[model samples]
Target chain A: MDAYEDLQQATLHDIPRSECLQLLGVARVGRIVFADDEGPVALPVNFRMDGESVLFRVSPASEMCLRLNEAKVSFQVDRLDDFHQTGWSVLVRGTSSYVESEDLPVLRSTRPLPWARGFRPVYVRVQPTQISGRRLVDD
Target chain B: MDAYEDLQQATLHDIPRSECLQLLGVARVGRIVFADDEGPVALPVNFRMDGESVLFRVSPASEMCLRLNEAKVSFQVDRLDDFHQTGWSVLVRGTSSYVESEDLPVLRSTRPLPWARGFRPVYVRVQPTQISGRRLVDD
Candidate 1:
C-alpha cells in the first residue's frame, strides 16, 4: 500500500538447526513458556546454552520454579529491529527439569548470570526436542 | 555475594492497570502464547491495544490463526534494561476471537499495522479476563 512495498515485503526464511543453536548461544535472554493452572504463561529469564540444552537459574520460592518441573515447555529467543521491522525468532520445544545438584558447580561456571539478584540457587534446564527458527526480512 | 548486593536486591512491585495499559500502548512488539499441538508456543507479534483488548492481523492460513478462535491465550509485553537489570512485565490472559467483519473498519483504523506484507485480512482480538503486571527493580 505504500512506496516501499517492494522493500517492505517481509520474506520469511527457515533457519537451519545449526544456525538456530548458534543464535541461542549468543543470546543472553529468552522467554520460557509453560502451561499454568489458568492457561499458558511466558516469562523472560536470563539463560545459557549448555551443549544442546538451555540452562537458567530461578529462586526456589519463585512462581516460575514451582511450575517448571518436568513440564513440556517452549523457550523462545528473538532479536527485533524496530527501525526496519525485521527480526529472527527461534523456538525450542522441550521438557524442563531441575538440574542435578552434582552438576551445579559446572553449570554455575558456564551459565549466564541472572541480572536480578535473589536466592536463585535452583537450576533449571530444558532439553530441546525440537529447534526451529524463522527470520522476517526485506526481500 | 557481591559488593552491590544491597543495590542488587530485586524489589517486586505491582503495576496498576492504568499504567499497564499505557505501557502496552507504546510497545511495538509482544509475544503471544497459545496452545499448540507440541506444547505452548510463544511467537512474537506486533500488536496494539484497542480499548481493553489486544488486536493484531494475521494471514488466515497461518498456524497462529488456526489456533486462535475462542482460545485461551496469554499476551505478554515487557521491557528489560540489561545494564541496570531492571524491568517490568505485563501478562494478559484472555479469550481470543476473530474480529467481526462489521467491526473490521474501526479496528483497521485503530490497530497497529503489521510489518509483514501479505493479505493479512484476518484480525484477531484478545479480550482480557485477568490482567496483572509486576516490576523487577534494584531496591
Candidate 2:
C-alpha cells in the first residue's frame, strides 16, 4: 500500500494470513532474526510450522539457543526468482521459547530436521504475535 | 567452532574475510536485519558490495529508509543446496547511512537495480564493523 501501488510494471500485494501460513508450511528454510548484545543477527535455519508457531532446532550450546529464549524475534521465509524479478516473503514476529517437555513428544512427531549435521537437541518454538506477507508480481 | 566441529557427517567451516567478500560480490539478493520499535525485522534487498561497504536502495518513504540511517544493521547473504545439504552464508554487521549527494553519481555507476519495481531514490551504505561467514560442507 505504498507509492509502488500505481506502478505499471509491477504490483505489490499484501498476502492474506491463510495463504501466508500455507506458504510457510511448504518452505523448509527461513532466516530467524534476533538481537544479540552486539546487534541484530539473521541466520538461516530449517524450520517447520506447528499450527501457527515456527519450530526449529539448534545445538544446545550455540549462541542462538543461549540468546533466543524468551526473546522477541522475527522469522522470515521467502522465494525469489532473480530472472523473473518476482517473489513472495512472509514475516513472523513472535516470542521464542524452548519447547516444553510435556509437548516434546507431540512436537517430535512433526519436528523439523536441521540441514546442518549436529546434535540439535534444543527445540525452540516461536509463537507469533503477528504474521504478514507480501508478494510482488508483474502487472 | 561449536559441538558440530567434531561431527563426522558435516563440517561448518569459517569462511575467511576475502572469500566472504567475494561471495557477497556475486550474490544479488540478501536480507537486511535491523531493530524496529516492535522488534527485529528482516527484509530481502538487492545489494552490491562497494569496496567493503554494502549498498542498496529503498523508497524514500519506506520504513527501511526512515529507520536505517545511522543505524546498526546486519546484512546476510547465502546460497543453499537443499539436496546436497551444503551451503555458505556471509553476514556483515555495520552502521548504515545515506550516500552523500556528491557521491551519488559515482555510486549510481555500480548501483544495484532492485528487482521489485519501484522508484528507489535513496541509497544507503553499510560500513562494516565486522564481516564473518560460514560454509557447511560434507565430510
Candidate 3:
C-alpha cells in the first residue's frame, strides 16, 4: 500500500456521469424527498433506472404518491462501507409523473429487484434535469 | 405470524421504537437533512446511536452542521439487503449541537467515536423530539 493510501482521505473531483448512474443502479434503495403543505417529507423507496429516467412503485395510500404530481422531488442513494472505508453518493432532482401501465415492457427490462415482490407497485417516474455524484477515496 | 401481520402490508408504524433503534445501530450509515435559506439539503454521514439519540461527526465546514444548530434537523438511517428482501429504517427529528469539550467524559460513556486515532471528528449531537420508523415485508 502506498503512503497516500494509508492516509485514507481523498476527495473526488467530477466523476463520470455513467459511473454516477451505475452507482444509482446498484443502489435499489434510496430516499425520496418532497414538500407538502405542512412541510418537507422524506421516505425510503425502491427504484430502478430507466434510460435517462428513474422508475419506482408506491402505494396510493402512501402520502409519497400524493406529493408527486405538484411538488419537485429528490432521490438520493449513498453507500458508506465501514469495512472498506469507501463511499459514494448520487443525488437526483426531478419532477414526478405516474407511469402508465402500458410502459411495463420497457420498465421490466432490468428486473432489478432481488427482494421479495410487493403489491402491484403504483409507479412514478423521475426524469433528471440535474444529476451529481461524489466519492470519498483512500488517499 | 399474527393475523394483523398477515392481513395487510407491514408499514413504518408496525415496528416499535426500540426495534427501530436496533436497525439504526447496525445501519452505520445515513443522511441528515435540514432546511435553510436555500431550502432543504440532505447530506450523508456515518453515525452511531446514543440512548435514544443519534450522534455523528460533522466537520465545521459541513453545510449540514452550519444549518442544523439548535434548529430541528432530520436524521435518517436505513439499509437495503436485497437477499433477504427485508430492511428497516429510522428517522429522527431533533436539534443538533456540537458536544462541548468539557462534556467528553459523559459522552465517553456513550462510546463516542475514536476520532483522535484518525480524523478528528467534530461531534454532532441530535436530540430527537420526534421518532418514526418503517419496514418492508413481503407482498
The lDDT leader among the candidates is 2
Residue B59, model 3, lDDT = 60
Kindly report which residue stretches of model 1 are placed more than 4 angstroms away from their true locations once superposed: A1-7, A105-107, B1-10, B105-107
lDDT of 3 by residue, A58-78 (tens): 767767678786446777877
Estimate, for each residue in B17-89, the C-alpha lDDT of model 1 and write its tens digit.
9888898888878889998888898998888888889988788889989999999999998887666777998
Task: Estimate, for each residue in A1-139, the C-alpha lDDT of model 2 and write its tens digit.
Answer: 2343344365689999999999999888888899998889899887889899999888988998998899999999998766676789999999999987576537454677777776787889999999999998877
Q: How many pairs of residues collide in each model?
A: 0, 0, 2
Cα displacement (Å) at residue B31, model 1: 0.9
Off by over 4 Å in 2: A1-8, A105-109, B1-8, B105-109
Second chain TM-score per prediction? 0.89, 0.89, 0.74
Candidate 1 recovers what fraction of true contacts? 0.53
Question: Clashes in model 1: which pairs?
Answer: none
Q: For each candidate, what TM-score against the reference?
A: 0.90, 0.90, 0.76
Q: Candidate 3: where is the Cα deviation over 4 Å?
A: A1-14, A36-41, A100-107, A110-121, B1-13, B36-39, B103-122
TM-score of 1: 0.90
Model 2 C-alpha RMSD to native: 4.1
How would you order the candidates by lDDT, starting with the best? Answer: 2, 1, 3
Specify the poorest-scoring 10-residue window by lDDT in model 3 chain A: A1-10
Kindly list the per-residue Cα lDDT of model 3 for residues B1-139, writing each as its tens digit. 1123234333343568878777877766678766655345466776778777777776666565677667666788776665555777777777777777665435454444421124435677788877778777645
